[model samples]
Target: METKAISLGRSLSVPFVQELAKKGLISVPPRYVHTDQDPPIISLDSSSPQVPVIDMQRLLYEDFMDSELQKLDQACREWGFFQLINHEISSKLVGKVKLETEEFFTMPMEEKSKYVQQGDLEGYGNMFVLS
Candidate 1:
């Protein structure tokens, strides 16, 4: 089978929000305001939109496999992300990771800067590449 590389056009350089915040600007600059974009679609119903949920238990069972797979595909297409349930990873481990992530975010900028993205999108930095 022949394979082709997919290109996302180019990497878009965005103004560093930290530097902008340091400037103490009262309002967001007009350049950052996207007036051309349509307003977000909000449902009027009392119930809120939910993050797609995919249960691994259903996926593992023979009878539910096909339907679960379809749901997973739909979730990926419509929501871009989904909350995974019945994943073997314990809640304790999840909590530890969450706490560590929060602590990392709370670290001083000088400390965080040590892990700043150098070239490829692997470390802490703005990921605003325009396609």
Candidate 2:
């Protein structure tokens, strides 16, 4: 599988978007963008209900497992994403990781390309999809 992915070709680069945006093309390329009018293709509304924020600390309590599991299940079903709080990971390390990510994203695409895995699509770019 890893060999198959590397042979598929290089992952997509966000710097391509940056170049386009510099020319005032802020939107994605046409292949990835949609303007369908038959039915609205996107939603930008924020007044709807919010995504769940799970408390990781509750998972430590065996007695609270059932209720927490119910919340986790509902969150997974409704939003498919959730923010975990109080997981005990170091906040300093988290901040450093985020900072490094920002730095990597801001680096020139040529420099970032150094991270592309020799065997897989795990890199500073998009997935195995050719687009």
Candidate 3:
């Protein structure tokens, strides 16, 4: 019997692997396996540093001083992305929206076929567009 070798990427979780094994798609042993031996390299001597951490709470609660604005501008210019520590958006609503979006995307093609866009008219199914 020919055994097929499978390559598991770095981001895949172990539980996913076990689930695949249970489904009999891939025959993975019941032990942790490290397929790749090469480790990621890190440069210690480089002067350029990692992304800067932004404190959103400070920006929200404290007075918006010139120094703070400068720091914010500098962060936007340098990193282009920063973490929001204290966001006001509700986590529950976000999760619900995410779930709904996933469910909508996973709907059957036949079901999705019901929604047809018409020219000029903003309506579902067969419709004519008004110029």
- Give the clashing pairs for model 2: none
Query: Model 2 compared with the native: what TM-score?
Result: 0.61
Query: Best by TM-score, which number?
Result: 1
**Reference-based TM-score, model 3:** 0.32
Q: In model 3, which runs have C-alpha deviations exceeding 4 angstroms?
A: 1-48, 62-65, 94-131
Local lDDT at 3 for model 1:
86
Each candidate: what lDDT? 0.80, 0.71, 0.55
How do the residues 1-131 of candidate 3 rate in per-residue lDDT, one tens digit apiece? Answer: 99865533223223433245557865556344445544333668566465566666667655754555677788898667765555577999889999987886566545655663423234333232111
What lDDT score is found at residue 66 in candidate 3?
A: 58
Q: List the candidate 1 regions with Cα displacement exceeding 4 Å.
A: 1-10, 16-46
Clashes of each: 0, 0, 3
Judged by lDDT, which candidate is best?
A: 1
lDDT tens digits by residue: candidate 1, 23-123: 89999877677887765558877576777789999999999999989989999987778999999999999999999999988787789889876565678
